[model samples]
Target chain A: MAERCAIVGIGQTHHTARRDDVSIAGLLREAALRALDDAGLDWPDVDAVVIGKAPDMFEGVMMPELYLADALGAVGKPMLRVHTAGSVGGSTAIVAASLIQAGIHERVLTVAFEKQSESNAMWALTVKTPLQAAVVAGAGGYFAPLVRGYMQRSGAPEDTGIRVAVKDRANALKNPYAHIRDPNLTFDAIAGSPMLWDPIRFHETCPSSDGACAMVLTSERAIPRPKLAPAWVHSMAMRSEPTQFAGQEKINPVSGQMCAKEVYSKAGITDPRREIDAAEIYVPFSWFEPMWMENLGFAEVGQGWKMTYEGATALDGDLPVNCSGGVLSSNPIGASGMLRFAEAAMQVRGQAGEHQVDGAKIALGHAYGGGSQFFSMWIVGSARP
Target chain B: MADEAKPVTNIKTPMRLEYRYSAGVATSRFLRGIGQGKILGQRCPSCRKVYVPPRGSCPRCAVPTVEEVELSDEGTITTFAIVRVPSENIDVPLPFASVHVLLDGCDIPFFSVVQECPVDQIRIGMRVQAVWVPKEELTSTLQSIRYFKPTGEPDVPFEKLKEFL
Candidate 1:
């Protein structure tokens, strides 16, 4: 059996389209320092550092972690780098937590980031396969058809996407560090926004941001600190699948379902939708909110949009989702998943300033990347499991 | 300490990977624009977000930036890098300027080549104009704007371009 690991600290950079003020090293340092500060420990307290991100090509840098090692204070310590496409951020965090869970390290710092300003994501993601001769365009192009497919199959109304956009932006308003905090935004504005991928609108998509997210994971013995309450790691799990395969369900992906199942089981959860008080989900596109709802067992596959339609995910709803605005508000591709993970910890620790789910005791953080091939999830609670 | 005194034999493996990409249709248009003496951007009808090297959809709004807007040949340098050494795959000249320029009238700024000046002279918030190539050399990519040169105007105050940071 694996050892128990709990998250004692978390940090993230103010996400934006461009972080021109700092170099890649400078960005990582900013997040690491914050995590160290939150843990009430210095760089010397960290046993190891794990860096993860989407693709190196996005930043025009090759294996950037090698150059960033010293800046992250990992000069003489063991370091590992992870890449699992879009879900890389969450997978990276799980790997660092595993080190503590395995009794290898008492405190591990895991960080993930993306500098999209360095290169156009549409260009980097537009890979030309030899036999595939489709001018299908960027990431939005590839996912649009699938999103359309979900709408048609689920009979979800066109306004469902608008609701998600408004919901996430409103949640972003509470997060002071969130990018593009527009208090004047409304459902009308989101619905009236230009439609990029037919059913998908402008506000429904995630921004190409520059950001870094980090956390300090510690073993059971390392905890029991006096400064602040720590969010105990109840369960953590990850799953992956190939990019494409015949007859595979991309919208309600099986990998995501499996990841959640494993986590709920490990954490002794029976009814996730009710048992979990809050959730921070990765919704790069607004439509993903409902699609993931069904995949995560929040509702039946076709009935996922019903959950959003009834406003069940609102701040005052039964299960508030994306209370920190989520990726729809700020997305640094690599750091997006870690942001979900950290946001969940923030809730359990009573650190969520404005978006706090009132008296919340349990929550979930989820992230998925690529053509929905990768998945990482965790369950955190105020009391130790 | 005792293990340090013993002779050790180890094996090493050499591994390498390379990413080769083509300038697609949109990139071709931008590069073609660079080849010529013009700058181009695509406006999203859905959200009105103008994308440099104009592509299909805006990542934020999920709307196709369809309107091809011809921008002024001038802008400001937000940040830049003086390429002293490049990787094996690089085919450009050394000491070249890779600068992000805020295209005229556009909300978001983009990267462009800086030329017709010394590498040491470039500074953030510097007002510079695009130096275009002959019309015959035009392509449909960002390369259309050959590079930015010194505008001879004073540098914009730090507070002025703080948002670009």
Candidate 2:
């Protein structure tokens, strides 16, 4: 049987469009050192390192873990690299937790980062490849059609995405590390933004950011020495499906459904809406929050967007979502998933600073990548599992 | 019914792409060295292993490879592949040897074309040397080394070459 694992340390960089002050190595060290400091430990205390990012091409670095090993104190220690597209951050954390859970290591440090300033995110993601159809309009153009499909299927109003944009951006005001913090942002500002893709406004999209997130996971024995109350791992799960197939459901993917089912089952959660105190979900385009809600079983199909309209997902709502701004506010691509996971842990530990969800005990962290196919999620709680 | 039962067809789409990739600090130095007809490699201070195409940090030691080491042009061929099938991008003639040469004083092998020798005679552990283009034609590109030719020296021992392969 696997040993119990708990998150003892969490740290993130102050996300921004351009972190020109530091090189790629310096950027990663900023986050890793913070995590080690938070754990009250040094590089010597880490047994292994697992790192993740969106794509090597994004930073113009091929297998950056090779170059970042020293910055992370991974010299002479086992280091594993993970790249499952957007969900890589959460997957990297899961891999670290697995090491502790397998009794292979007492402590494992996991990190995910993206230096988008080093290269262009749009061109890197949409670079044309041999034999593939030419759909090189970047992520917003590609997903806008599917968003339209979701609206048609659910008959949802036109302002759902805008509402999500406003809510998440407002939440970002409380988060100092968020990349896009416009204190004067309003619902009309979002609605009035230019339409980048039909039915998708420019303000509703996530900004390209350069940042990193790191977490120090340890065996249950290390919990007593933690600086703050530990966020216990209730359950962890991942799921993937092929990129495309005829008649496949893209709006509400079966892979996301299956992944949520596995995580909820492992965590002994039946009613997710009631059981999950807060959620830090991947909502890069704003509308994905509600779409994922339906896919993750938080709400019935066609009704997820209503939660936003009724303010059920606000900071003071019954189920607060993206309380630390979320990807909509600060999306560092590769680190976006771990940021979600870290925010959820912060909520449970009451260490989220100004954005802390009041009295949050149990929370969900969700991330999806690669055309909504790849999924990784974990549930954390204040109390031990 | 016949129309629906017909076999599916493939769509052919050609794409023209452009990108300006950054070589970063370590690689920029290596590229500059190639322009000067000098081959450079980085040595890991902790492990002492040298890396061709010098990276900013070493993968094994996880430390910066700031120490520069000049590599000898003469080396041993650790392994190779004989290419026969052709593609639009394949410039070498059919049945030519694409070789992995472990340059003398360097720990890792780098890929290069092996010319001036028959593909059948290009065996592993064979001694070879880099062939550079005309001095005036030299650029920062790896293409500066046109190919590698047999050094006509004694074959390196398999025991010494096994780790590289």
Residue lDDT tens for model 2, A111-209: 999989887787688765432123225677556656765775677888999889888999999999999999767998999887665556889899999
> What fnat does each of the candidate structures reach?
0.00, 0.00
DockQ of 1: 0.02
Instruction: Give a tens-digit lDDT track for model 1, residues A183-268.
Output: 87798888887665445567888889998988998998887372668888899999987654323466688889999999999999
List of chain A TM-scores, every candidate = 0.97, 0.98
Candidate 2 deviant stretches above 4 angstroms = A130-133, B1-165
- Candidate 1 Cα outliers beyond 4 Å, as residue runs: A128-134, A224-226, B1-165
Q: What TM-score does candidate 1 get on C-alpha atoms?
A: 0.70
lDDT of each: 0.79, 0.84
TM-score of 2: 0.70
